[model samples]
Target: MFGSQPNGLSTDNKMLSFQMASDKVKGILQLKKYLEQFGYLNYKNSKNRTHENDDDFDESLESAIKTYQLNFHVNSTGVLDKKTLSKMAMPRCGVADIVNGTNCMRSGKKNHHHRHGSGSPFHTVSHYTFIPGNPRWPASQTHLTYSFLPRTRSDAINPVDKAFQTWQGNTHFRFTRVQDSSNSNIKIGFGRGDHGDGRRNAFDGPGGTIAHAFPPPDGRFHYDADEQWAVGATPNSFDLETVALHEIGHLLGLEHSEVEGYHVSLHLYWSH
Candidate 1:
């Protein structure tokens, strides 16, 4: 979304301007909504106390932009720059990186995390975090049963299987596939739009929100069926296994980290 102005913002000094604004009124508002949806903007703290057409670029909005920039390693200019917008448009997990005013992507120290390195004592300085309460399955429940919903794509079988295997290799969690849905602990499925979970977790077509999953005990994993999904990392198609592994981390009581793109290794920070 770009505005008619040279800097992609409105020339009218009535509202805050940015290069990503297509139409000063409509575009900027949509950007705020985007930020809000992914757990960025918190309207509760602001004096305006609204999520609508009020476009002032308030403190909360600027803070949200900075947090997003920090999570993605972009310049935390607090302004809607080209790099920020480009990243915002990319397809990502529907789960909010910031949950309940706590930036889940960046809450703890990277040095305090527990990880396994191949050669050195530490390979990555990546930070890891958990759900709000750190709810986890009992230590005895490490062997979990999983099954695919009937509506899930048939081709997802192998990729999902491999994803589970990868997790088993890295962590103590072991996943076993089952045919009977009633006897499974975790259920994986593909859905479109508001597929009965709720409006907050709805899938937006192909490129915006790709997939979402619940944290431990609530083991439902969903992928947006509208996306162009492929098994391995193929051209132009989203990798189902890669996403599955990330979602599986949620199922195992893990929140995504800032360094997710570079470090997908199992951190095993579970407190259970």
Candidate 2:
């Protein structure tokens, strides 16, 4: 489902050209969107579209691949090698990795004074990060009331409960499940594709994006119902507790960490 422009090389050891057939444009477009969404690539100048509506591998895409490689500690080559494709295929949260074009995950930038520096997203910090604005719950609002909406899965109930407990055990925040979603601090449920938040926040199917959560004050948590979800120790299905824990982290004002090999992006069934 993927092709590479591995042959393209520039005089200065950069990728000036690459290999891609017009026939492979479809998959490349998918890859393009993926990179754009996660913040590996962007198009600020419409006039300078490197690909230029064509199907060939271009400089823009190569740069995006290079950024992704740098983030994931892969080889700096801009080529879409087999390892790159394998990493991209992993299931991950729907959250954007680069908030406002600033990467939220990358090692060696450690700061203990603040989680996010400059009262904005950019931070010279450690592996774990927070949202752009660092929107955390109020100090007085440590106890958060949570509720499950109509599409809440039964198997997810216990796992979600356990996840909340895990959060409470570790942090000052406490979560309580309630029957009222309207008044709840966090609302969680299942949805498929464009559930309600609009097309921009739609779920991409089972393996691409398993779940998404809004930061503090906007407690909209959603899971892709099309996924094969399990409670615990189930084969060939993603564990609800695992994803629930990651999503819960978002609700508690934490963003995805830059730690290598430790992420919410995984298809647990791969080994099984």
Candidate 3:
């Protein structure tokens, strides 16, 4: 959600003043990928649930806790609060390696405008294709057109390029970077403003929100101007590669993770 207002340093000062709890770190660590899938913390009760009945296994215990909370219509806080602790089938230790990197920034908290709701239904398989070579070079791929925007620095250029490359390497998609031409299928532009496939404005929030890709066939992507991108040694502070990986997942017909409901259970139990 990048189109929201750019409040600048006053917003940063306000954010810096707030303190987050240690528990949040553990929650983040445990739920990182889950959050990426579902986009938020929303846990509800499970119906037609069966207990694993294995007291010895930690996962079984967790499932039991989930069942207990669901049946009772209480929030499955997941944390070992006083009420949950006694009912928790197996006790687990808190994670030590919590809160290592930057604080996770919310999408619309500031004036940043990019907002995501449930996306279109996912295809059984992704349709995008990938073309080889560095995207910065004109000879790379067929669908892409690349250009250096003077407003943005070279540092920004390199990381954003890396992010796109990383996505191509990891997924089965056909894409290529080309020189500026209106005929190109996908175009990459660098600047402070918004760009991408969705109707939502692309550029929003602080630097950490990084870059996003357009849905495929026209898989355009862009990077934010505010960030200080590090190419080689530090692996770039914001991990542009990871963000691109996620966005490319979007471009390839995947939607934000849906809540686990009867539909999901049916998919899990019946579908391949």
Evaluated with TM-score, which candidate comes out highest? 1
Off by over 4 Å in 3: 1-152, 156-171, 193-202, 205-208, 233-236, 256-272
Q: What tens-digit string does per-residue lDDT give for candidate 2 at 47-80?
A: 3366644545667777778878877767878877
User: For candidate 2, what is the TM-score?
Assistant: 0.80
lDDT, candidate 1, 1-272, per-residue tens: 11111221222333335534233444666667778887888676676465445655555666778888888878888877766665676666777777787787688732344556564322344345777678798888999999999978888989889889977866788889999987799999999999989998888776677788898798899998887888776766777777787788788877866663332122222221
Clashes of 3: 18
Candidate 3 per-residue lDDT over residues 121-235, each given as its tens digit? 2223332212111123233343444444335454555655665575454434445555554556655545454443333344444532345544445545565655544554353
User: Candidates' lDDT values, in order?
Assistant: 0.70, 0.68, 0.34
Evaluate candidate 2 by giving its C-alpha RMSD to the native, one decimal.
8.6
TM-score of each: 0.81, 0.80, 0.37
**What would you estimate as the lDDT of candidate 2?**
0.68
Off by over 4 Å in 2: 1-26, 50-54, 107-127, 266-272
What is the lDDT for 201 in model 3? 42
Candidate 3 displacement at residue 176 in angstroms: 2.5
